[model samples]
Target: MTRIPHETSGEPNPLRALGLDTLRRRTSMKWRTYPEDVLPLWVAEMDVPLAEPVVRAVTDALALGDTGYPAGTAYAEALADFAGKRWGWAGLAVERTAIVPDVMLGAVEMIKLVTGPGDAVVVNTPVYPPFFEFVTHMDRQVAQAPLGPDLRIDPGTLEESFRRAVADGRRAAFLLCSPHNPTGTVHTAEELSTVARLAERYGVRVVADEIHAPLVLDGADFVPYLSVPGGESGLSLMSASKAWNLAGLKAALAIAGPAAGADLARLPEEVSHGPSHLGVIAHSAALRDGNAWLDALLAGLDDNRSLLSDLLAEYLPGIVHRPGEATYLAWLDCRALGLGDDPAQVFLHRGRVALNSGLPFGTGGAGHVRLNLATAPEVLTEAVRRMAAVLE
Candidate 1:
């Protein structure tokens, strides 16, 4: 298995710097001291190599020399199998699934399908940046329901937005992320039901992004929004990108239930057609056979996260890590540490670790920084060491 060099270290192992190599290679710098020795804890891509099954699948596809349009039922069948075996919310068939280029495309298309320009698209702030653009770029209005301090949705605020939109008689839609980005909140089943009921009652189409659903960490179960009662009426988008580190492959499935599913399937033929041949192949391999490798990767991530938590406690004790139930990203509240202005910038310039500025995740994310812990321990440890040195 061709893996990053840092991934193979032994016990007393230095933290494996997953993206550091790529960062170093791109910046033309060396480890731990190049102009402040920047450690990149941003970007969600894993430093580890592809799972063996994924590699084999891609290799076989390449060997066949068939890099044509990925029009087929296999990818959809694979997705259906994954949804059933993993989440237990059925009612999905291959015909109801369309192979899209990526989650973003599916999302933008869903919003466009459900609403027109000047209509409203509601999103929880501090969301994936693209959600903002997906709505605004289309000349639609964006309703930001910022999360409260607990890092969960402020249902009160969201309800207010819905009421306002309905009162104005404007069409509305919702763009939701499960195992949400940056914040790493795995929304509870009951919460999802509530959200669904809101959408149904308000006549808003819900576009649920479950791209990170496969990587629920810390013993939490990954609940598909559609699996909850009344959830099938919403649109669900999933991908192999996060779990298998296959974002470059660009394959994702958009499933609509008998209710929303039919509307989704009836989307423009341009969007409903097949996916990338490579993406389809990679996704199929990931869903059908990447469980063992995923387990190992999760174990590695769990260990890395534990190390991060312990170090933050011991060194940067002032920083708060909103408990991570899913996703490799950690939302660090650096406000308590008194890092002036933007902690992300302070960490980048002083601590030499590049983290996602919290402001982008939404209102409550301000003064927070998101760190990607999907790398090797040696790398993460070194990053923490640098961060601790700057603050300690």
Candidate 2:
């Protein structure tokens, strides 16, 4: 096992420290989904070691034979403390938060709280793929409100979508992805306030998926939706999974705004049964004691983001990539490569580089691909080189 440095000690970049040989040996979807010859950079999983605190907490619990159903509000409290110290927002009320299986499950429950089967759920297009899948699977219609040219929420477009969504007195819900996936646009407090106002005016409920909140890189600030004025009726789901690389540990919190407390209360009690007790312990430990490790990870990611930009400019000059303010995912515009609608397929077959096809991200996603950036710098450089070779 590689010796991961302690938080207090200055350590090398985590993303670069993990060797490719070690990574390929793992059996996660990111590594096993493709052939050995292909370079996989499509999923949200990071190729780094778990934070020391998280590992210690989980192992301690296992040693004591303490695996049982999750209980208590420790997870919520830990998150509340982290949010206050990190984002300077004290709006997280532990009393109004509930434990759920994961971010997507929490989102499904939040959407169900204020909406009924067959109602409309509005989403920003070229957004997360699961936003469409999970909502549709729940028997709700998905309305597209594609992002503006700058990839930020367009109020005019959003308002229009909201109007159409609630037509005929139908109750609608807006599913917001904060520090949004793929594109990684961090929503400002001002932008969230506007969304709250629009949702209020159009009578649409807002359910924010803030799973990537803790992963916001430099030059960006994450605004909790519930902290904004007029956002009292909104709901947000957050977790330490993304930041601590704890996705396999299924746990998340669904927090309701002051005005939506009643709706959140109506969530079925059985929903809490989905998360693993060990997952709760790991997530709680991450929120409370993983800050030092998280800080180190963020610094490494910032460097990777810059390195990716430079690599793209030199190898794939025609590809347009607006460096995102958050998340380890990079959305690349491959239209200029003349690879047609789904360029990812071309890269996979010709370059042996696996990337997420943009088509599933909904409208405005074509001629694009999403690449994961949470890997060793050498792996990222080689992936870009392989992709560029396809065009040659």
Candidate 3:
């Protein structure tokens, strides 16, 4: 696959950011989930406009009436190339990659292929809600390891869970969330190396959920799992969905490291048949031609992350807010405000603002809410204002 690099300034130019009226017109779940009176900022979807390359690719596909089943290895090749350029990941093996319907589905299938029925799947607590849901959906048991005080994975707790997972001579796998969701904590190379070593010692396979790799904001470096020394036996589920705002596209890739290639090859062929053709096309184009657009989006999101910090400090001074280094989600700690375990309920009922309930995110989620920071600056400003009004 051929790729063209588009140079971009690291800082966001204000002119490129979206405005309030342009965003409110969106008909996505973020907008439609709440009544017009409430300011919605819960869902993972972004309020920004689509990238030009992505839009053009989808439009061309529709014009050609190319809506059919997905084919070929173009998507994999494109991502491999993008990975090399974006994150210094030069070890991407296109032939060892398999396309799937989406990241969660790809992860579940990868878990099934590597481990038997009733195998335990370990996950970090207060993580993405689907990590909890998909493990149960596959009939595998879920093992929880709560994050440390800084919201990063706890090494000691992780080892304990790994030991418990295979205690009875049972098989297990770690569903590692890189640049972790809800909290948006980007894992460092050292942290991932530790996880890889731990997995090796525990006789467990590691499947990294790296769907957020491309969205690592300034000051945080995204290290691909397979690029780590002890990670050659791990598997990775990647997609353009999260970063490119293409979640509804229905396409993702399950990648295997050199040592794990044979295991991935064992994946059921029916799994590869699930991706949509247009989704594959859009993803490929995004990887090949969407870097400049992606850079701009990242710059805007960087501004928003900083913007949220200011907004929180000014309005909701009691709430603990950590500006995320990656992802558009801000995990807010509302414990100091005495909002109970699920503050989202309080915000919606009193402040008329919709935010993701942190309760469903598993352990350590009490007294928290996941605020989507991908909207226009005005929307974020209003969300905090509403939240503060209720407290006042």
Candidate 4:
């Protein structure tokens, strides 16, 4: 495959740097879930090479036979440094953070700290499918606060859900997907502040899944939910897994705001054992030394975003896609195609292109499909072509 370098940075676009044959040879779910004939662009996994720093870190640990239990606050400290330098926020207190297996597991532990069984765990739909499945599996009731027409948070809807969630003074928790999944909408500071205020008013603890924090593309800013004025009691789950293509590494951090230190401290010590030592080493290295590579990946994603829009307009004109400001996921509205609620199935079965069906994402998910944009530009274009062919 021809290597496409980022326009400004001159760094090779990770998405285009790897060839299809190279990708297919891997055993990851994104490539292996479907047969060789189907184009798989359904999951969160990014189709890219590992950052050099991450590779070196893991390789060095193995070379030294340093495979053992994870120890120290290196990951937390590295994240704090990255947060301060990148997001202009220095409030990541290492003492208030705990290592978890991954973002979802961290979220589960954080939710457990704030609510009991059967308590309502609020979410904005259509959201990441796991947000519904995992919360429900934990014995907590899932409450919906669907986003507005613009794919941003609907304060009225959110407030109404909050009111219902905490009815009769019941304990509730909000699982906030910052730089939201599927949609890729980066929540602004003002919007997040409003979320904080409302959560405070309703006595609902806010657990922000900020795994996509580093993927904020051009034209937006990522407001760390705990950095807002009214967010002192919020908890956040962050990781390099999503941003740096380290999902298989299985490492994440659960950060607590100043006021929520006590609650975070209540997290079971065994929870820390879930993350592999190699995973910790790789994640810490990514945070500490992966900026240049991350910048290249972001630029590639930006290019792919524009490319996708153009391709959709030229081919699948009926599909409505409001390009998101963060992450590499594009939530495309397929309702206009008259495909009913699950267009992904039509595309998959007929077009031989796999996509995430909207039905499982809940609420607004129906008539929609989430497309992963972290692959090569050619693959993305081909995926759209196949999708357009389905309508023909």
- TM per model? 0.90, 0.97, 0.95, 0.97
Which pairs clash in model 2?
none
Model 2: residues with Cα > 4 Å off, grouped in runs: 1-9
How high is the lDDT of residue 36 in model 1?
41
Cα lDDT tens digits, model 4, 304-386, are 99999999999999999999989999999999999999999999999999999999999998999999999999999999999
**What is the alpha-carbon lDDT of model 1 when measured against the actual structure?**
0.77
Report lDDT (CA) for all predictions. 0.77, 0.92, 0.88, 0.92
User: Each candidate's root-mean-square deviation in Å?
Assistant: 5.3, 3.9, 2.6, 3.7
Query: Model 1, range 1-392, lDDT digits (tens) per residue?
Result: 11111122222211243355454544221233335456667877666767778999999989999788877688778777776766665566676677787888888877777888899888887788778766788898888887777878877888887777666888898888898887889898888888888888888878898899888874576777777777777787888898888877888888876677667756788774545788889989988888767766766777877889998998888998866788888988888878864788888888888888877666676788889888777778888888888876
Evaluated at residue 83, the lDDT of candidate 2 is 89
TM-score of 2: 0.97
Tell me how candidate 4 scores on lDDT: 0.92
Candidate number that wins on TM-score, 1 or 4: 4
Candidate 3 lDDT over 3-111, as tens digits, reads 2333574635432467767767877787788888888888888876677789999999999999989989999999988988877778999988999999999999989
Candidate 2 lDDT (Cα, 0 to 1):
0.92
- Indicate the TM-score of model 4: 0.97
